[model samples]
Structures are given as C-alpha cells and as structure tokens.
Target chain A: MEIREIIISLFYLIASFLFIFGIKRLSSPATARMGNIYSAIGMLIAVVATLLNKNIVSFEYILLGIVVGSAIGAYMALKVAMTDMPQMVGLLNGFGGGASAFVALSEFYQKIGPDVAPDIKAAVAISISLLIGSVTFTGSLIAFGKLQGIVTGKVVKFPLQNQLNILLILALITLIVLAVIYPQEQIYYLTIIGISLLVGVLLVLPIGGADMPVAISLLNSYSGMAAAATGFVIDNNMLIIAGSLVGASGIILTNIMCKAMNRSLMNVLLGGWDNTASSSAVSGGKDVVIKSVDSEEAASIFDAASSVIVVPGYGMAVAQAQHAVKELMDVLEKRGISVKFAVHPVAGRMPGHMNILLAESNVPYDKLYALEDINDDFKTTDVSLVIGANDVVNPAARSNPESPIYGMPILNVDYSRTVIVVKRSMAAGYAGIDNDLFGLDNTFMYFGDAKDAITKLNNELKNM
Target chain B: MSDLFFMVYVFVLAGFVGFELINKVPPTLHTPLMSGSNAISGITIVGALVASGALHATEHATLATVLGVFAVAFATINVVGGYLVTDRMLKMFKKKK
Candidate 1:
C-alpha cells in the first residue's frame, strides 16, 4: 500500500471511531453538541482522505462543493433558531439524497455507451442508489416545506394513493431491470429517475405536519442507504462504512421517536390519517374553564407557592423562553421556593426536546424530572407553572379512550393544586388538537409571550 | 490502498459526517436513535463481503465471478436490511397525536 493510502485508511479508522463516540455522546441531551463536533471532525478526515485518492478526475469540484456546503452549513449553524431545527434537518436530508442521486446519475451518464461493460454489478448498485436517492431527495424536500409551514401537511388522500405508490415503485424496479439487461438504454434509467422523484413527492404528500419529524428521520436514513449503494457502484470502502453508519443511526432514531409517543411504527406511518379525536371523547369540554392570568396575578401564584414545577411545551420553544425560564428558576430557588422542571416523555414534538432547550439555557441537570417522577409531586405542589405547554399536560390522554392521544402518557399537571398554563392562545399542539388540561378547574391560563411573562414575574418577585 | 479503496473510504466517511450533522441537530431522541443506528451501522459487513470475493489469486474467473456474486448478495442484504429497519423506525413516529 502507498503511504498516502495507509494514511487515508488510518483516517477512516480514526473517523469511524469518532462517529462511534459521537453517537454515544449524543445519547444524552447534555453532550450532544460535543458529539456533533466530533462527528464533524471525523467526516472532515474522511473527506480529506478521499481527496487524496487518485481517481476523482477533478478534486477541485470536491473543493468547490465543500466551499459551498460549508458556507451553507455555517450559516445554518449560526442563523437557524432552535425552533426551526426540525425544518433545517428536513432540508439537509433532501440535500444528502440529492447529492447521492446526482452522483449516481453522473456515473450513468459517463457509462451509457454501447461498450460499457456487462458489469451488472455496477449497474445494479448505481440503479438502487439513483432510485432511492431521487425519491428521498424529493420526499425530504416536501417534508421540509410542510414543516416550515410553506405548504399544508394535510393528507391529500386520493382514491388509490397506496396503490399508485406501489405501482410507481414496481414500474421503477422493472425499468431498472430492463436498463441492467440492455446496458445501453439510457432512457429507461431516466424514466426510472423521473418516476422515482414523483414517487418521493407522493410518499410525503399524504403525511401531514404532525409527523414531519418522523418523515425527516426516515428520509435521513434513505439518504444514508443511497450513499451506501453509491459506494457499491464505485467500489468505495469509505462510502459503504460511512453510509451504513448513518443509515443505521437514522433508522434507530426513527424508532425511538415513534416509541416516545407510545405508538407502533406502523400506526404512525399508516394509521394516523383519520381524525384521532371523536366528539364523545370530550365531554362538557369547558367544565373547568381556566381564566388567563396576568403578570401581577401570576406573580402572586409564584410568591405563594412553596414549590413550582415548570412544564415546558412546544410553545416555549416557539417563544425561545428557555433562558428567561432559567432566570426565573434561579430567582425562585434563591427565594427559598423549590423549582423543578417536569419533562414529559413526549414533550414537544420530539424526544428530549425539553431537556435540550433547558440545557441550552444551562439549566442544572438535577433540576429536571421526568413525568413519572414529577407527576405524583404535582398533586401536592403549590403551583404547576406550565410554560407554553399543551398536549403533554392534557387530562384527556389519561381518561378518554376515543381521543387521538389516548394511551399516550401526559405530564399529569392537572393534579397540581394550582395549574398555571402559559401560552399565546388556546391553540392546540402539533397534533392540531385541543388540550383538555386548559379546561381543568385547577388550571389558569396566562396569555402572552412566555419570556415576557417570566420577566414580569421575576420583577414582581424582586419587589416582594 | 488502491483508488478503489480510497473511493469506498470517502463514501463511508461522508456517512459518518452526515451522522454528526444529524446527531447535533437538537432533536428530542438522540440517544435511542444513536443506540439504534449503532446497531444498524454494524451492518457495514458490506466491506467484508467485497473483500471476500475480490482477493483470490488462485481461483478461476468463473469461481471469482461466483464469489463476487455472493459478495454482492451479502452486501445487498446488509444494505436492504439496514435501510428497511431504519425506514420502519422512522415510520413509527408518523402517528403523532
């Protein structure tokens, strides 16, 4: 082996190790940033090694790609609000799939002559990469659009959507087989690519906004597999290793995300189109209507409370109230009042969303409590300060079987002696359903920006 | 290391890099996803597959071809299996309430 080759291989080994460590670190919401940095370095190493290799024809394109990619990446890192992270992820997944698809198409373009080898091996690999990559690219883009609210995520459920998708997939497969046999038929592959791209749009079309995260994760996994298939096409070792790594990781993430909501993967994918709530499930929905509390009144609740449990939800994320909340927590703690964070299993849209937001504000890890740990305490607690929270604290999940969120666990904040809900309005969560917790007798709504409310409360407490 | 190996390395390395980007995103379920992906990334058995068929100096061309076919089959299984499981997991989150 050449010296450079040895160096590159060593780079691969080292990079792979970082990926392992980075992934391990990511398991905790705390070290996830460091994990990401390590993985980034590993990728940098791998890219450098690939550039060192002889057959790239033009390394300058790789450099050009890097300059463009890094600029976009850095801008996203700096400019993207934490609230837009899911949409950003969806867009990035699209780029990955598109890149892989382009690479496969380029390879096919280069080898389309009459004498291009009978090497069905290369043909099959490239075809698989192209098909999945094109589909992933389009599907991920659609998911991003929906997440960003640029497009509605309403189910455009047609008369035969599933059947159409199956037919499209089969047609693409058949075209690939014909392309493999003909070897010179460029049109067949092009047709397959076009059809696959359409199929991608169709895949995400029926999926609504609520499931965008899952759609994004699944597309991320597809992008990984597409890369792996490209690895096979070109006989590239790094491609296989790196692609499989991502492909596998994306899959695992998708599953855990699913479980967090207490739904089977199949139920999430195929069963969520129909309305999850029925009218009978919610009785006298306003039996315990909560009146919105102002800053001064909310202050009184804070001052009187012996213990305050802050239950964060997606609304807090939208308002970026984490730091303000953290500041409020410190003030309460200093005042000899107990402050604990109640984090539900499926709080926010994803797993550990609350933890990440709080961690970003440098909240103490010890102050955080999972739903089960904090649920019982709320019954006796003086005040449950639900910040921009919704479905996670709903009582319907606990009692209403016909409800969409039935069987899904909640924060049980209703049990608290006094429940203060902070939100902009009575808008539902990502599930687009109303929360019954707002109607509880013990609950009081605080209508306004969560950060502003917290700030007002802090000022009032300081005066006291 | 031949050019072939270098290309493969780049492909896989890109994989790891993307992994970091995704990992760093402030998603709710990084750990379980990480654990799940680690189990799937172990399917890099695709490397072993190619190695088995590509390095046989004494074998006839036909035998080499057969081994190559098997290698492709095994690697494809790894690819298909890995992707399918990941797809299934992602689909799990679609039922958001």
Candidate 2:
C-alpha cells in the first residue's frame, strides 16, 4: 500500500478511537461536556484527512458547502431553546438521513449499468440506503413537527392504514428486485425513493404523541442503518464503523425505552393506542374516587414530611416547572427533609427529557435516580410529590389486570405515606386510562398548573 | 481477506465498542449522547466531498454536484448542530454547589 493511503487509514483509526472515548465520557454528568469535545475533534480529524487525501479535483465547492453548512448549523444550534430540544434532535436526525440518501443516490447515479457492471451487491446497498434514509428523513420531520406543535400530537389514521403500509412495503421490495435485475432503470429507482418517503410519513403518522420518544429513538436507529448502507455503497471503512456504532446504540436505547414502558417495539410502530380512546375507556368503567387538596394544605403536609420524592413528567415540560420544583426541593432540604427526583425512562417527549429538565434547573445529579433505583425508596418516603406526572406512577400497572398500563414498570409512588400529585386536572394521562392511584386513600391531588402550584407550595413552605 | 470481510470485521468490533461505551451514558445524558452520535454519523460528509469533486469529471456532473452540495450541507448541519446542541445541554447539567 502507498504510504499516503496507509496514513489516511491511520487517521480513520484515530478518529474512531476518539469517538469511542467521547461516548465513554457520557457515563457521568461531570465528563459529558468533555465527551462532546472529544467527538467533535474526532469528526474534525476525519473530515480534514478525507479532504487532504488527494482524491478531490476541486476544493471550491467543498469549501462553499462547509462554510454555508457551518453557518446555518451554528446559528440554529445557538438559537434552539433547551425546551425545544426534542425537535432539534429530530431535525438533526433528518439532516443526517438526507445526507446519507443523497450520498448513496449520487454513487448509484455515477456507477449504474452503462459504465459499471450491474453489481447485485452494489444494487442492494444502494437501495437499502435510499430506503432507510428517505424514511428517516420524512419520519423525523414529522416527529419534529409534532414536538414543535406544527403538527397535531394526536395519532392520524385512515381506513385500512396498516394494510396500505403493507402494500407499500411489498411494492418497495418488488422494485428492489426489479432494480437489481435491470440496474440501468433509473425510473424504477426514483419510484422506490418516492414510495419510501410516503411510507415514512405513513409509519410515523399513526403514532400518538405519547409514543413520540420511542418513535424518535427508532428513527435515530433508522438513520444509523442508512449511514451504514451508505458506507457499503461508498466502500468506506470509517462510515461503517461509525454507522454501526450509532445503529447499535440507537437500537439498544430504543429497546431500553420500550422495556421501560412495557410495550413492544412493534406495538409502538403500529400505533394503536390513543389518549382519547384510553381516557374514554377509563371514564366508562367504575367511578374513580379522588382526594383533591389545595396547594396550601399540601404545603403543610410537605413541611411535616421527613422525606420527599419528586417525579416530573411531560406536563412538567409543558408547564416549564422544573425550576419551581427545584426551589421546592431546596426549601424541603433546608428544613432537614431528604429530597430525591425519580425519572421514568420515557418521561418526557424524548429519552432523558426529564433528566435534562431537572439538570437544567441545577438539580444535583446525585439526587436523581432511575425508576428501579428509586422505586423501593418510595415505600418508606414521607411524601411522594408527583409533579404533573400520571400513568408512570399509576398503581394500575401493578394491581389491575385489565389496566392498559398493567405491565409497564412505574414509580411505586402509591406505597408512600402521603402521595401529593400536582396536576392541571383529574384528566387521564396520555395513556387515557384512569389511574387507580387517584382513588387510593393516601393519594391527594393538588389541582392547578404545575408551575404555579409548585411555586405556591414553595412560598407556603417558606412562610411556614 | 476480501474487502467486504475486512469491513465486516471493523463493523462487528465497532458495534461492540459503541454498545459498551454508550451503555455507560446515564439516562440524563442520553439526549446528548444521541446528539453526539448524530454528529459522528455525519462522517458521510467525507463521501459527499469526494462525490462532489469526482463528479466534476463526469457527463452528469451537474446532478452529482447538486447532490454533493446538499449532502455536504445536511451532514455539516448534523455534525455541527448536533455537537453544539449536545454541549449546550451538557453545560446545563450542574452538580449542586
């Protein structure tokens, strides 16, 4: 091998190492910033080495692309509010998918039948990249829309939707077969791309807002697989390595998220559950007895409590109550009460959303525990303060055999001595099922906007 | 070994490494970890650069050039935006003083 070629391969290897090191740093809150820096540096090394490797005939276009791309990226990155993080993540995934699709399509355009032989392997790689990439591109856009409120959060379905999706997949497979057989047919390839885009929309449309975090993670996985296929299309070793890493991590995260909710990946994809149906079903059954309390009364209970567990959810995100809750935690801690935050895996609109929210509010990392880690602690807790969270703490998941959320792992807030829930109303959660916890004798609902209620309680505690 | 076989070797090894490294990321850091990986996956910008320049010699150069420009832009957005946003999120995570 040429010395230059060997050197370039070494750069790729070095870049991969940095990427791994960067990801490893994410294990702790303290080192995560440094991890981002390491991965960015790794990306820098890879990009620079590839540009300098003597393959480019023109640098002008590359330079222009980089300048324009960097400007827009930097601007958007700086402008995005922490609250809008999920949408930003969706948009980033979409861009990655688009790039992979374009890259693979360009290669196919440059190398099909007339000049290059109809290599079946190349054909397979190209089609797979295009398929996965286009789906991710559109699916992620829809997810972004949902998070951004440009699209309705409710599941959108039509007659025979699943059947139509099946037909689309069948057609896609047939086109792949045809493309492989007649590699020169550009029209067939384009048609496949179009169909894939439609399928992407169809696939994500039926999924309700409650399942969006799972959907986002799944699309993240798709984007990784798309990049991997592009790696095969371009015969780049680094692409495959990086792509598989993202793919594998995304899959693992997605599985973790699914297990958290006790829902299979297939169920999330098929999108059958909706809040309206579940809520209606819940209200239809036996009447639920709720014990409602004012924030002042709850504050008195909180003041007397020896220990408290604060569980925040998507409603907390909606009400932007993390900071208020942090204040409440501080007030409680100052009074010699132990305070901890319990986070469900799929708590917010995306994985780790609640953690980010809590962290952003300067909640101590040591005080935050995952569901299982803190579930047992709830049993002996003086007060389980549920901040705009439902379903996740529902005892029905543990007690009711017919409950929709029956098998899902939840924060055992019901076991606490006094369960004070801060919510807007007694409405069922996104699962639409009535929470059996509300009817429990020890459960008291403090109804109001989460931020206002928590702020009031904080003040009340201070006055006490 | 065949070229494909070598690529597979890299793939399998990297897959293990990625899984192990990522599993270490606490749930609090999952968003940032994902954002960081999103940037890493933008590694395809290398191919985009090469394709754009290489296509300058072909008859369908214009089409390839357009696609290349877009690929570069999108990948850049993924890389730059992703990394920056991740840093932004991570910066917000403070250990209580």
The candidate scoring highest on TM-score is 2
For model 1, state the Cα shift of residue A246 in Å. 1.9
Kindly list the per-residue Cα lDDT of model 2 for residues A370-450, writing each as its tens digit. Answer: 987888998899999898889899887887766777789999998999999888987778887788888889999899999
Docking level of model 2: medium
| Residue pairs whose backbone atoms clash in candidate 2 | A278-A432, A279-A432
Each candidate's clash count: 22, 2
Q: Over the full model, what C-alpha lDDT does candidate 2 score relative to the true structure?
A: 0.85
- TM-score, each model? 0.78, 0.96
Model 1 per-residue lDDT tens digits across residues B42-62? 232323233223333332333
> Could you tell me how far off, in angstroms, the CA of residue A253 lies in candidate 1 after the best superposition?
2.0
TM-score of the candidate numbered 2? 0.96
Model 2 chain A: weakest 10-residue lDDT segment is A274-283
Which residue ranges in model 2 land beyond 4 Å of their true spot?
Answer: A112-118, A274-284
In order, the Cα lDDT scores of the candidates are 0.64, 0.85
